[model samples]
Target: MRRRGPTRLGRAAALALAAVIVVTGCTAEPPPPEPQPGRLVGAPAPLDVTEVYLQQRIAAMTLREKLAALVMVHVPGTDAARIRSVLDRYGFGGVIIMGDNVGGPARTVAGLTGALSSEAGLPVLTAIDQEGGIVRRLREDDAAAARELRGLPASAAEQAFRTRAALVAEAGVLINFGIVADVTPDSSSFIRSRTLGESPSAAAERVAAAVRGELGTVLSTLKHFPGHGASPDDSHISIPRSSIGMRAWRATHAVPFRAGIEAGAPLVMMGHLQFDRISPLPASLSPTWVTILRQQLGFDGVIVTDDLLMLQRSGLPEYENPLRNAIRALAAGNDIVLFVLPADPGSVGVDLTGLLDALERAVGDGRLVEARIDASLHRVLSLRRAASGLVEPYVDCGPKCWGESPRSLALADVPPTG
Candidate 1:
C-alpha cells in the first residue's frame, strides 16, 4: 500500500473509541426499579359480599316460605299458645304487636318473641309502633319518652335512642315502626304528638339522630315516607292524599325522609296517602315515589307498606283485595307488606295463609311474576340479615316498663297510638 498520513490510526485514541463502543453495546439496561411501599400496603381489603350469596339464599327458599317471608302480619293475642299456633301454621316473616300483646309486663312481649323464635330458629322480626308519646305500646305515656329526644343536640338524641333501643331490645322488638318522618304541622293531624316536632328541618335533624342511635341496637324505620300530611284523614280509616305539587313536596314534605335516609335508616314505611301531582296511585303502591326514593334519594334499604289491609278502606277502584294490594305493593318496590287487620268491624279479618295462597296463584297465573316476588323476598331477607337482634343485650325490662303493674309514665294512660 502507498504511505498514508501518519501511516495508521493513533493507538491510544483508536483503543479508547473501540473500548467505549464495545462497553455501551455489551451493557444491559437495569430492570425497572422495584415499587416503593404504598400507604395502604398491609391493610386488608374490605369484605365484598357478592350478590351470588344473596341469590343463593333466595334460591334455597320454597315458594311458600318465600312469600311468607315478605308478609309482616299482625298477631292479635299475646297468648303463647295462640301465637305459637299462628306461627306453627304459617312461617310469617314478621309479627306486629300492639297494646293487646303487652298484657302486664314487657316480659309478656319478650315471652311472645321467645316463643315465636323457639318455634322457628330464624330470628323473627318482632316490630311495634313504639314512637313514644301517644304511639308507645310498651309505655303508653311516652310524651316524656320522646321529649327526651326532641330538639336535643344530635349527640343527645342519639344517646336517647340508645337508651330507648335498649328498652325496645329488652322488650324483644327488633323493629321500631317508630321515628315518624312526617312533617304534619297541623295540630289536628293524626300524627300530631307522635312527630319529632317544631319544623321540618329540625325534625329532619332529630330523625337522623334517632336513626344513628338505633343502628347497632335496633333497626330504625322512617315512617309515612314522603310525608303523610297530604290528606287530613287517618290512614287507618281511609286512604289519604297529599295535595302539594312536586316542587313543594320536595321542598317541605320530603325533607325529613331525605335526612332519615342519609342517616342510614334501615327501613322506610310508605303511607296509604296519595300525592296526586307526583303519582295518581297511592304512594304505597306508586312506583314513581319509590323511584324517587331509590334513584334520587339513594335509599337502598327496605321499603315497607303502611298496611295492605288499608286498601279496602281506600275506596279506590284500583285497589281491590289485600292480596292484590300486597302484590302491587311488592311490584311498586315495597319489600314487606304490613297486613294490619282494620279495626273496622265489617271488614274481614286478615288470613295470612289465604294471602299466601292468593300470591301463589297470582305467581302461577302470571298476575305476579316470580322474579318480582323474588325481588321483594330477597330484600326482606337481606334486611333481616343486616338489622338482626344478634347484637342486642336481652334483659328484663322489668315491671317498670312491661310489668303487669308497670309504672305509668303518662298523665293518664290513653292507650298510646296515633
Candidate 2:
C-alpha cells in the first residue's frame, strides 16, 4: 500500500523545524575576514593582471594598429566629437589637450576628456601641459610654478604640485606633461625662468618632490629631457645645440631627470635639443641617449618625443618630413611619438595611414626590427593599461596608493597664472 501524504498539521510542524534549522545554520556561518590593511579585497593582484592583459592585447593587434597605438596626437578644438573622431579613426593611444582644447570650466573639460576616452577597458592617455607657469592649460591652476618654487623649500614644491595634480585630475586628464626638469644657471637662458632650480642638486630635490606630489592623482611627466638649458634657442623653431661633454651633462643636466625618474615619474619627454658631444642628433632621435637613459640611469618607463612637428618647423630640409621624423624617433627608442596637430592634419602633410604604412614597411625591410616595435608597444600599452585604472585599483602598493590626507597648503599667496 502507498503511504499517504503528511496531514496538514504534520506538514506545518515539519516546515517549522526546517526553517529553524536553516536560521541556525545561517547564523553559524562567519562573515568574511576584513581586508588586510594595504591590500585589495576580492581582486587579483594588479601587476599580474596588467602583464597578462597587455600581452593579450599586443598579440591581438594588427601591425597597423600596434604602430598607431605608439602615436599620441592632438586635434585643436573643444568639440569632443571632432577630437574623438581623430583618436578613434587612428586608434591613437593618447591625446595632448592644449589650451584651446580646454574651452569652458573643469567640468566641461571633463566631458571632453570623457568623450575622448571611449574605450572602457583601456582608455586613451589624455595629457595636458598644466605646469602652472608659462605652460599651464587650465586657467585655475595658480599654484607655485618653477619661478617661485625654485626659491622656496622642497616642501613648497610638493605642496604646489599636489594642488596642480589635483586640478589636472579634476579635469579628467590622465597625464600631466608638466614638471620641467631642465636646470639652468645662465640668466640669459630661455629655460631659466622655467627651471625649477638654478643648480643641479637643487633641481633634483624639487623634481623628486614634484613627482611625489603628483604621485597618486595623475601620471607625472618630466619634460624636455636631456635638459632644455643646453641651448638658448627654443626647440619649436630650431634645434638647440650644446657643446657640453658627457661628464658635464651627467654632472648637471642628468641630475634632475635621474631624480625625477627615481621619484616615480612614469614618462620622460625627450627634448629636441642636440648635445653635440654626446650625439649629433637630437636626444629625441638618438639611440645613444636612449641607451644612456635606460641602462645608465635605470629609466624603464615610457620615453616620449617632445613634438614631432617641431623638427619640421626648424626649417631644416632633413627634418621636414613628418613621417621620416616619426620613424627616426621610434627607431631611436622612443615609446611614443607625439604630434600636436591642427584641425586639418593633411595641411601639415600628416597622413595617418601613410605613417602606419611607413612603419610597417620599415619593419618589413629591417629598417626597424620587428622586435623593437614589439618592445616599444609593450611599454606604450603597459602605460595605457595603468592609466586606464586597471593596475592602480588592484594594487595597494606604490606612491600611487598613498592615501595620506593632503596637508593644508594654501595657494592664495601665489601670483595669478601668467
Candidate 3:
C-alpha cells in the first residue's frame, strides 16, 4: 500500500500518456490514396455524327491549327485577300462581321463567306448581331426593309421578334446574336430601353419568337443570362452584381432564358455579371447558373460565354486573367468560351496555348473529368453541324462576286424588323 501510494504520480503520468496516444490514434487517418488520373465518368459516351468527324479532324490537328479554330477574329477591312490570309493563317471556326466589314452588304457577305469556305477549306459560321432597334447590325435604305421592321410595344414584342427572326434567317448568317433581350427596366436600368419589355414573361415570349424565326437559316443565341438587366454597369467595363437573390432570379431573370430554350434556341450566351447569391464567380463561370441552364431548364443546347477577355477588362480580380476564366467556364459547363476582339492584338489576353494546356493538365490530374470535356465537345460539334450546310465545292468569286449569284438573292427578301 505504501509503495502504491508513493508511485501514484508515475501511474497518473502513465494514464495521461495512454489517453494522449488514444486521442492521437482516433484523430489519425491514412492519407487519401493519390487521386487517379482523370477519366470520363457519369457522361454519355461520344455520339456518332458529322461533329465527331470534325472533332476527329481537330484532334489530329496541330496545336496552332487547334488554336486557329478556336478564334473568331474580325477582319480589318473588306480586303478579301487579307481576310483570306487571316483565315488561312488561323483556320478559324468563323468570322464575326461588324458594320466596318460591310461595303455593299450582299457582296461583302457573299464574298467573305465564300472565300472562307472555299479557299481555306473551312466552313465558317458567319455571325452578326441583327437584333433590331438600336442594336441592328444590318441596315438598308429600302423602304420595304424599313417598313417590314417595326419596333412593337412590349405586349406585341413577341410577334415582332418572330418576324425579326424570320428576317434574320433570310440574311444568310449562320448565327443571329440577340443583344439586350434579357435586360429589364428595373434592375440595372441601363439596358432597359434595349429590352423588349420590362416584365420577365413578356421578355420570354419575345425571346421564344426570335428563336422560332431562326430555326432554319440561323441559330439564335439569347444572351446575358441570369439577367444583365439588373446591373448598372456594363460587363464590358465592370463586373456588375445583382441585388436580387436566386429566388427572385428564378422568377424574373430566368423567365426569358427558359422561353428561349423551350423555343429550341440552339445556343445561349452566359453573362459576365457576378451573382453573389448564386456564386462569387461571374455567371459565365458559375456551375450553379450553367447547371440550371442545362439540367434544371432542360436545355441541351450549347452554352457560350460572353467574351472572357471582356470580363478581364471589367476589374474583376479573379477574372483579370482570361485563361483562368476560360478553364473555369468550361469546367462550369460552357461549351464555347468566346474571346471577342481583345484590346491588345499581340497579347490576345487569353493565351490559347495556356488554356489548352490547363485543360490537358486538369484531365491528367483528375481535377477535370474527361466525360465533361467530351460532353462539351459533343455539344459544340452538334451546334456546328446544325449551323453548317452541305459543303459545296468552291467556286472562286474573285472580282465577279457571289452577290451576283442567284443564291445570294435568297437574302434579299429577309426584311428587317425594327
Candidate 4:
C-alpha cells in the first residue's frame, strides 16, 4: 500500500490557502488581549472598594470621633469660616445649612459648603431643607413644590423633585431633606400644604416618582417617618400624637414610606411624633418604631432624627434636654442625631461638650451598647461613601491616560491593605 503525495493542482491550492491564512492572521481583528494585572480596560474593578474603604476608615476612628460623626449639627450663620470652625472644632461628620446660612446665591452657598468639606474622597454631609414651597432654605428653588405637585400627575412630582434636587446639588449640598412623604386629606391640617398627596395611594405614587427623579443628583430623604399626617399638630412645637395601630398604619400612612424606600431613597427621618398605642415615646426615641421601620417596612438605609432642638421646643419637662434626646435617639437605632442650633446654643440648653460627654457616659455605662453605635456608624459612613460616588465601579485609564496612575492613586487611600 503506497501513500501518495498531493497532485500539482492540490499542491497549488494548499499553497494559496496557506497564503490566505497568513494574510487573515495579519489583517483580521486581534483576539482580546490578555487582561493585564492592575489594568482595567473595559472591565469593572471590584465593587467592594468602597465598602473596604468605609470599614478601614471607621476602624481608625476613636470612640469619641465615632460618636461625633453620628451627630449632624447646624450653626446659624452666613460666615463660612465660622461654621467650618465650629464643625472642625467639634469634628462633626455633617452640617445642615439653614436660612441664615444661605446669605446670598447658590455660588455663595457653595463657598460655605465647600469650606465644610476639604476631602473630596469623603465629604462631610452638608444638608439643607430645600423642600421648595414653605420649607425651602434656598429662595432660588422655584420648582413646583408639594403644594402644586399634589394637583399634578406623578410625572410632575418627578420633574419637580428633579429640578429641586439640582438646585440643592448646585449649592454643594449632599443631602436634601426635601421630600415630604406625609399624606393628609384634611384641608386644615398644618402639613397639608407641604404634602405631595391627599390620599395614601396618591402619595405613594408621587413619593416614588420623586425619589426616582433625585436618584443621581443628590441624596434624597423621606421625612417625618410613620408619617407627619398621623397628627394635625406641628412637630416643631408639639409632639404630635396618633393612635393608629400597625394594621391601620400599614394600610394608610406606611404606603408612601414603603414606596419611597423601594424607589431608592437614602435616608428616612424619624419624627418626634408619638403613637401612644405603639410606643409611649415619640418615634424618634422609640425602639418599637425603629424595629418596625427596619423589619416591617424593609428599609436598610440610614435613619436620622428630625431636629433634636424641636424636642426641647415641645416645652415638655421630659423633652427639654437635648443631650437626653440624642442618647435616646441613638440608642433607639437612629444613625444620626440632628441639631439645628442658633448662634447661642446655650439658650436652648444644648452644650456640645455636655452632649458628647453624656454619649460617652452612655456607651461606658452600657446604656447604649457600643455594638449598636458601631452598626449605626457603619450605615452612616456607608451612606457617605455612596453619596461621594466612591462606591461606583472603578475604571483604569490604561497606560495612555494623564495625571497620577489610576491603580496606584486609587489604592493609596483604599483599605484591606493587610
Summarize candidate 3's per-residue lDDT along 1-418 as a digit string, tens digits.
0000112354467578669868788666545533222211221222233443556555666544443444455665667677667666556666676677666655446665556554333466667777776666666422121113224443344445555555554554667776345746664466665675557876776666656655665678888887888777777778888767878888888888888888788878888888887888788889988888877889888777777778767765776776667667777877766766533556546554565676667666766566676666556655555555432223322211211222322343322111
Per-model CA lDDT versus the true structure: 0.71, 0.83, 0.62, 0.83
Worst 10 residues of 4 by lDDT: 396-405
**Which ten-residue region of model 1 has the weakest summed lDDT?**
1-10
lDDT of 1 by residue, 1-418 (tens): 1111110234356567668768789666545533322212222221123233456567778888888888787767668677756655777788888787787556656877777754232466788887766677887333344555565666776666777777788787888888888877687877666677567887888888889878887889998988876556788767777667988988787898999999989889998888887898888988898899999889988888887777786676677677778877777878888886534424655566778898788778877788877887777766665544231112322222121121221322323211
Total backbone clashes of model 1? Answer: 8
Q: Candidate 3, overall lDDT? A: 0.62
lDDT, residue 319, candidate 1: 75
Candidate 3 ranges with C-alpha deviation above 4 Å: 1-71, 118-122, 141-172, 342-370, 391-418
- Candidate 4 to truth, TM: 0.83
Clashing pairs counted in every model: 8, 0, 3, 0
What TM-score fits each model? 0.76, 0.82, 0.70, 0.83
Q: For model 3, where is the 10-residue window of minimal lDDT?
A: 396-405
Best by TM-score: 4
How do these models rank on TM-score, best leading?
4, 2, 1, 3
Candidate 2, overall lDDT? 0.83
